[model samples]
Each structure stands twice: as structure tokens, then as C-alpha cells.
Target: MKAVVMRNQTLVVEQLTAPQPAHGQVLVKTLACGICGSDLHMYHHCENVLSGFRNANIPVAFDPRQGLVMGHEYCAEILDHGPDCDKKLKVGTRVCALPFVISPTRFEHIGFSTPYPGGYGEQMVLAEPMLVAVPGDLPAPIAALTEPLTVAVHAVNRAQLSGEEVPLVIGCGPIGLAVIAALKARGVGPVIAADFSPARRALAEKFGADQVVDPAVNSPYASWLQVAAPSDYDMRSPLALLGLGRQPRPCVVFECVGVPGMIQQMIQHAPPRSRLIVVGMCMQSDQIEPLMALPKELNVHFTFGYTAEEFVHTLHALADGSLDAAAMITGTVGLDGVADAFTQLARPEQHAKVMIVHD
Candidate 1:
């Protein structure tokens, strides 16, 4: 089998031996896999990522020096099952799964670690328990989106909105766009999205953002204030203790931009009592002023991957047409073109989500 791997911090395509499924695992042929921002981060900052994992005491199975296959968001077709597998789904069934496998000794991340190759390869092994069959007539490229969309689902779930709070998504990248789609799917309204890129702002609207803003031209926070005004109790005035001033309405801000200083910016600018959810994965050290958010009484939440239930829900949503994420797939490339695709994705205006499609 041919696989594209990260070798010496460079993407190299090589012919490798196909891996057989282990216990409780199933073999699947890659159909379509999305290039995630994390993949790009790992490609450029492998040493930093590994060091961070070690510092956090998190066990990392991947050794950058040894080369690792990297891809996670994927749709695949079932080929065979390993020993002790129930094989509930037929051999030809198409499916998507959370990108991880639970081994008897330890849990291994599918695309980030060794032994278990990622969707960049033509064939990969998946934990049978995590596999969710792609339903109806959804195309492989769209089906591959289940993984990334689940992140948005989980972020929204963590927000635990009261149905009154307006949502402000602060970025128009793929993850940010997914958050917009998830908010709309759940009937959350008056969504405001901000991005410097005009192309991303357009995609945000397509994904159901009620208003889009270019930070270079207008303030997204200002747009949020227009729709969500505080009721009573002004934070700025001492007389507000008597409920004399208008307080900002409940607002949930999604910090989808992973770059440094974004968190501090939100802390400084977000409305009082706002719930800020940091969904982006920042790879470097960032500074935030706790004193800035002290008076505001802001609630900050950092969200990671989705839960099992959220993943399943996202898959079903895509299948039933409740979550229309087809617009996110802007480009597709074959295995050999993976390196160039990575380069193209560096320009936000050039693409939203690029997929690696296998024949």
C-alpha cells in the first residue's frame, strides 16, 4: 500500500506494507480524508507538540524521527474484520469512526501515533466499536466531515446555552465554520461570525451566520452588541447595583482562532458575564491577563474533541441533511498531491477544507 508520511518534517510518499487489523479492529480502505489544521501544526511543529505532550504527562505514541502517517477526519469502506470481531456491518459497508483505537495495553490516536496508520494511507485499522456506518446516499467527501463537525457539536454542548444567549464565533476557519453550522442546526440564532478573510466570511454566511464581519473593517463585538443588549444592571456604573443601568444580554463567544493573543483579546473585549469557549488548538505558549476578566466575571472554557455520543449525533446529522456541511469541502487531492494541498491550505482565501480522495 502507498502512504504519505511525515519524514524529517517533510511529507514523503512511500510504498509500505499494509497493516492487518488487530483484536476488536476492522480494516477499512480510505475513501476521503480531510486535512485538519492540527495536521498542519504537527507537520511544522512536531518537536513542540511532542514536548508539550510530555510536559503534560500525556503519553504520545508517535516519534517524529521515525516518521508517522497523519490524517484523521476520514470516510472509509469496510474491507475485513480481525479475530474476535462481531462484524455487525458487512464487508462493503462505508463508515466513519472516531480517529483512535483502544489497544489492550494502551489507547492510540489513529493519525498521530505509530502502529496504527492514518487515512493518509490507502488502508488503516479502526476500532470496531467506534465505527459508525455512513447512512443514506451521502457522498464519501461529506461523510468524512463527521469527525471535524463533532468538534463543533461538542463545543456547543459544553456551552450549555440557555436558549437566550447570542453566539459570537470569532473566526471563519473550518472549525469556526463548523461551529456556525452546529449552532444553526440547534436553532441558535443571530449568529455573528468574524474573520479578516472575505472568502471565509462568505463561507460563514453560507453556513448560517446571521451576520459576518471583517475585523479589519468592523468590530464583531459591536455587531454582537447590536443584537444582544444587556437588560439591566450596568457593570460600568456603581449605581448599577440598584439595577439602574442596562446590562449586556447573555452572550457566548467561541474563540475559534488558535493563534496567541486571541484569548487575551476576548477577555479584554467580551461583554460582562459572557461565556467564552476556546475551541481552537493553540500550539504555542499564550499569555492571558486573569485580572482583565476578573471584574467582568467571565467564564472561560477550553474544549477539545467530542464525546462518543456527540460524534454519533454529528454523523447522523450529516446523514439526515440536518447538518449541511457539503459547502466546507472546497478542494480534493490524491495521495501524491498531499504536500501541495498542505501548501494551498495555508491561504485561507484559497480553501476552506481540502480532502485527500483515494480511488
Candidate 2:
């Protein structure tokens, strides 16, 4: 088998033995796998600090220590089933799978810390609990995106927003665009997407953002104020000088960029009782005024991964064509290009979703 691996903070693609499924697991032939933000983070040395944090760190659900495969967002075909594995999926059945697997006991022991193999290789051994059967008709590239789409789905679900109102999403990167697509799937109308990249804004519009804000050109501060206000601009406060009126905050806001400053800005411009879900991997400790968060009585939620049921829902959504995962996938490379893909992913203005093609 061919695999891309991280050894001593460096990445290389090399030939390796194919893995056999253990009890309760199945062997899968990787068809397509999506390069995620976290993969890039690990490639550029962010993983060492972030993945090792016992309390605050974002552990790569899958670790290279256990003979890791680097890709997480992927779809595969069941090739062989182990002795205890349920035989519901046939050899040719296409499936969307969760990159990480955790047992109930393990879940209780460590809330969100587990080491599971990822999908950036020619073959993988998938635990039954982490697998979701994908539709045969869906293209492999589209099927691969179910992983990230589910993240967006989970974020929206965390918001607890009603159908009566729309939502605001900060940052128009792949994750933010996924939020827009998922919001639309759940019948949420007119999602506002914010990003500094024009390319990203265009992608957001392609996905379904009713409005796009470019902080570099139009001044995000000014644009946010213009739409969110109506009252006294004393021209004294920073918010007032930006020309933003009183906040007519959206019912729900998804903070997908994870930038430290954006969180505080959202708090300032948020409506009286808006809910915000933090979805981006900011990679740093944020400093903000404590009172700003205390006064609004806002609900801030963060989710790790989609539940089993949500994973199935995400696969179904992709299969039925409710969400087009293909659009989110911007590039594909062979096993050898994994390192380069990671480098590109670190840049904010690069491709949307970069896939490592195994077939």
C-alpha cells in the first residue's frame, strides 16, 4: 500500500504493508480522501503543540504513532470484514466514515481524546462504529466531503436556531462554506458569510451566502456596523466610528475562523441573545474582556465530532444531492503530494478542499 506519513515533523510518501481489519473492524480501500485544516496544521508544526494538550489541546483524533494515515475526510469501499465485523456492507458498497473511533468506556475516560487512524492512504482498517454506508452513485470526491459537512451540520445543530430566523457565519473558508450549505439544508434562510478573501467570498456565494463581506476592501468593521445598527453613533466609540448602528444581530452566528480577535468582535456586534458556535481551530489562547461575554448571557458551544447518527445523516445528505460536496473539493493529489497539499492548506487563500487520490 502507498501512504503519506508524518515522521519527526516531516511528511513523506512511501510504500507500506496493507493493514488487516481487527475484530469488529473492516478493511477499506481508500477511494478519495479530503485534506483537512488540521492536516495542514500538523504538517506545519502546529500539531505538536495543539495535539498534545491534555486539557486544551485539539488532539488529532487519529495519531501517526499508531501507523497513522493523514487524511480524515474520506469515503471508501469495504474490501474485507473481520471476524466480529457485521456483514451489512458488501465488498462493493461505498461508504462515508468517521476518521476517529471511540468506545463508550474510552469516551468517559477521555472526553475528546482518542487515537484512531485517518484516511490518507490506499487502504485503511475502519472500526464498524465509525463507518457510514455511502450511495453508489455519488462520486468519490463528493462522498469524501461528508466528514467536514457533518462538522457544519453539528455546528448548526449546536446553535439551536429556529426555522423562523436566518444565521450569520464569520469566515468564508471551507468550514464556513460548509455551514452555509448545512444551514440551507435545515431550512435556514439567507445566511450571511464574512471573510477577508475575495476567492473565499466567491466560494461562499457559490455555496449559499446571501451576503459576503470582504474586510480588506469594504472594511468588515464598517460593513458589519452598517447592517447591524440603527441608533446613536456618538462617533466616539470604535464601533460608532465604523458607522455600525445598534446591533440587529442574527439569531445564530457560527464562528468558523477561530481567530482570537473575531470572537471579541462577534461579542461586540452580537444581538441581545444570539447563540454562537465556535467551529474553527484558532490555535491560540484568546484574550478578551470578561464583561463583554458576561453581559449578553450568550450561549457559546463547541462540538468535537458528529455523532454516529449525524454521520449517517451527513452521508444521506450527500447521497441525495441536498449538499454538493464536489464544489467544496478544490484540488486532488497523489500520495507524494501530501506534503505540498498540507503546505497549501496552511495558506488562507489557497484551495478549498484538497484530496489525496488513492485510485
Candidate 3:
């Protein structure tokens, strides 16, 4: 099979052996796959990645240096079943799957595993238990968003958001937009989305953000405060309070941008008793002052991935247009475009969910 193979710190279109499903697994024809933030991380950290290996005391099971096929946010069609596969799935059924386990002894992240392969290729193997049927009406490209959507959904769940807490999502990237979608799906609203990118902020408003904040304009926190109503806390401190905006106070801060010092920024700016849900995948080391969070008594939650139910829910939200996920897709590219797409995603002012269509 032809795949975008990553070799020596770069991706190249190369022929590789198609993955055969093992026992209890299903072979899926790659239909559409979304390039993920983690894929970019894998591409950069091929030789020296720490997060993948830090999960366990065992040696790194997935070494990108060995020519990896990277993609996990995918929607595929069932082609065949390996021996002892589940009885429910039928050939030609469209589906989204969790990268449950790469091998019995290793972790189950699809794009990172060389043995189990990934959706970047023409075909890949998924464990039967991980498959979730994609609705017949959902377009292949939009369906590819299930995994990332679930990631946002799960983060919202971690926030435990109710109507009382105003949502302030930092970074209007894909996950941040997913947070907005999930918030809207639950009828939780009056959201404040922050980003430096004008294009991204516009997308966020279209996705149900009540107001958008440009961090470059007078400190995003100040703008957020200007638009938001105050919580019960009588914040007397000059830096924390100006009483500018009449909208609801931003009580839940979703830290979706995973770059350096973002967490600290959110922490420094968060209101008293607010919860900071960290959704961004920051691969490098960073620091935050405990003193910033201490005064406000902020609840900081680190979020990763999603649940099976949430994954299916994301699919349903997209299918029903409850989430308007199709709007999230700003562009599409073929296999060869993967390299440039990675570069473009780094400065995501113009792109949201760029689909890698299998030709």
C-alpha cells in the first residue's frame, strides 16, 4: 500500500506492506483522515519524543524513527474481519474507531504504532471493540472529526459545565472549537473564545461563541471581563478586577492552546473558584506559578482524549447538524499534501480541520 511514511524527520509517500488485522481486529479501508496535533508532535519528536515513552517504565514500543504511518483522527470503511472478530460489524460499513491497543504488550494509539499501522495508509487494522459505526448521512471528511471532537467533548465533561459557569476557551484551534461545539450541544452558552488569529476567531463566533477575544487587544482577560458578568466573588485586586463587562463571568477556562506559558496566562487571569481545563497537547516542559492559582483557589484539570460514548456522541452531533461540524473543516488535501498540511497547521490562522482525502 502507498502511504505517507515518516523517515528521518520528514514524511514521504512510499509503498509499505498493508496491515493485516490480527485476531479480534477488523481491516478498514482508509476513507478520510484528519491531521491531528499529535501527528505533528510525532513528526517532530521522531527520535527524541518523551511523552509516548513516559507512559510506562517499559522501552518505547512505537519508534517513529522506524518509518511510521501517522494518523488517528479517521473515518474508514470496513473491508474484512480477522479471525474471531466481532459478529456485529459487516463489510462495507462506514466507521470510526478508537486506537485501543497497538499490541497486547503495547499502548493503542493508532497513528503512533508502526505494527498496527495508521489511517495515513490505504488500509489499517482496528480492534473490533474500538469500531463505532458512522451514520449513513455524515460525509466522510466530517466524519473524520469524531476523534478530535470527542477530545473536546471529554474536556467539557471534565469542566462539569453548567449554565452557571461561563465558558472561556483559550485558543480557537480545532479542540477549542470542539469545546465550543460541545458547549452548544449541551445548551451551555454565552461562551467567550480567545485567539490571536482573526480567521480563527471568526470561525469560533460561527460555532456559537457569544463573543470573541483577540489576545493582542488590551489583554484578552480584560476584554473577556469587559464582555462578561461578574461572579459572586468580590475581586478587589486591581489586576483581577475592572468591572468592565456586564456578561456572565468566565468561570470555566478551557486551555486549548498548548504552547508555552498559556496555562500560566489562564491561571493568572482566571476568576476565583474557577476551573481551568487544560486540553492542549503541550509536548515540551513549561512552568506555572502556584501563587497565581493559589489566591483564586482555581481548580486545574488536565484533559486528554475521549470516551467511547462521547466519540459516538460527537458523530451524532455532526450528523444531526447540532454541532455544525462540517463548518469546522476549512480545507482538504490528498496524501501528498500531508507534509505541507503539517506546516500550515502550525500557524492555524487559515485552517481548522484539514482532511487528508485518500486517493
TM per candidate comes to 0.96, 0.86, 0.92
Clashes of each: 3, 4, 6
Total colliding residue pairs, candidate 3: 6
- For residue 247, model 3's alpha carbon misses the true position, in angstroms, by 12
C-alpha local distance difference test of each model: 0.90, 0.72, 0.82
Candidate 2's residue-wise lDDT over 242-277, tens digit each? 435654445577888866787777677665456768
Ranking by lDDT: 1, 3, 2
Ranking by TM-score: 1, 3, 2
Considering every candidate listed, which one attains the maximal lDDT? Answer: 1
Residue 10's lDDT in candidate 3: 83
Model 2 stretches with alpha carbons more than 4 Å out: 46-52, 56-67, 104-116, 219-250
CA error at residue 336 for candidate 1, angstroms: 1.3
Tens-digit lDDT track for model 3 on 1-359?
Answer: 98998888888999888888888888889999998877887677654455546763534456656888888889999999999976597999999988777455666668877787788898999989888898877888988988889999899998877577778889898899989988988888678898889999999998999988888885666655655545533454544544433434557889998877989988877766678899997777789999878877789999887788888888888888787767888889888898998889887776988898986
Candidate 2, run of 10 with poorest lDDT: 107-116
- For candidate 2, give the lDDT of residue 327: 73
